[model samples]
Target: MAKAKKKSPSSIARNKIARRNYDFIETLEAGLVLVGTEVKSLRQGQISFNDGYINFKDGEAWLVGIHIAPYDHAGHLQHDPDRSRKLLLHDHEIIKLQAKSEQKGLTVIPVSLYFSNGKIKLQIALAKGKNVHSRKEELKRRDIAKDTARQLAKY
Candidate 1:
């Protein structure tokens, strides 16, 4: 029997506010088209997606507003810090996402950025905006869960 290879850690960046602002319905992993400096910057965990989102246009998906800081040692060859990067996805998935996103109040948002199988990948999701009341309820629920965990730790 062959031994299974262990996977190394690859998470690069995550959007902490996404969960609080939107309710995720589904998630999909897609490859990112990045330049050398962009990849290097991501490896250093210098990416931000606070304003990042997925845009579907002309039968393709593009990631916008993501900021990957220029590589510290790249000198003048550094890539742009903010650029619209293309996302690799199948035609069927792209069409499906486009149709779904066309619905009122629905959107596609980037959840996290990571490296998989030595390649850069992004985790995006189909999400719907959360109302103010729902946001408050989410906070309350999270607080209760935290309290419960703290109580359990004391036992």
Candidate 2:
């Protein structure tokens, strides 16, 4: 019998700098409500999550600042590249996020975009912004770790 190919989770976009900018408190997965062209664009790896965030308003969570490029073959029916999209989540989850985000310096940040079980899911986190001094200390620690690794490898 021919072996079936193993399916892996595929990422469309990632906010690579999010970890450096924010200290994560908790992470959650949510579904996206995307248009046809937007979905196609994501499949083509043409999305960016930089400066994007999740906001709760009117009892709904909305994704803002993500850019999904237009599909080339969509003719004039292409979706808006920068439109705010709805995030599908349970009411309880939304309320939890809202309560946490209401705290000072805490926010809901989109971490990455990926495909799961043939549907697109966004990974988001409740995070606190890092101060300048904290960011510098993190960088210093990272550099020290890298130096120690190099020294050990040289032995």
| TM-score, predicted candidate 2 vs. hidden true structure | 0.94
Top model number, lDDT: 2
Q: List the residue pairs that clash in candidate 1.
A: none
The lDDT per prediction is 0.91, 0.93
Cα lDDT tens digits for candidate 1, 2-31: 998978748888899999899999999999
How many clashing pairs per prediction, in order? Answer: 0, 0
TM-score for each prediction? 0.90, 0.94
Badly placed stretches (over 4 Å) of model 2 are 1-7
- Model 2, range 1-155, lDDT digits (tens) per residue? 99988778798888998998999999999999999999888899998776899989999999999888899999888798999999999999999999999999999999988888899999999999999999999999999999999999999
RMSD to the true structure for each prediction, in A, is: 2.0, 2.1
Question: Over 4 Å off in model 1, which ranges?
Answer: 4-9, 145-155
Model 2 RMSD in Å is 2.1
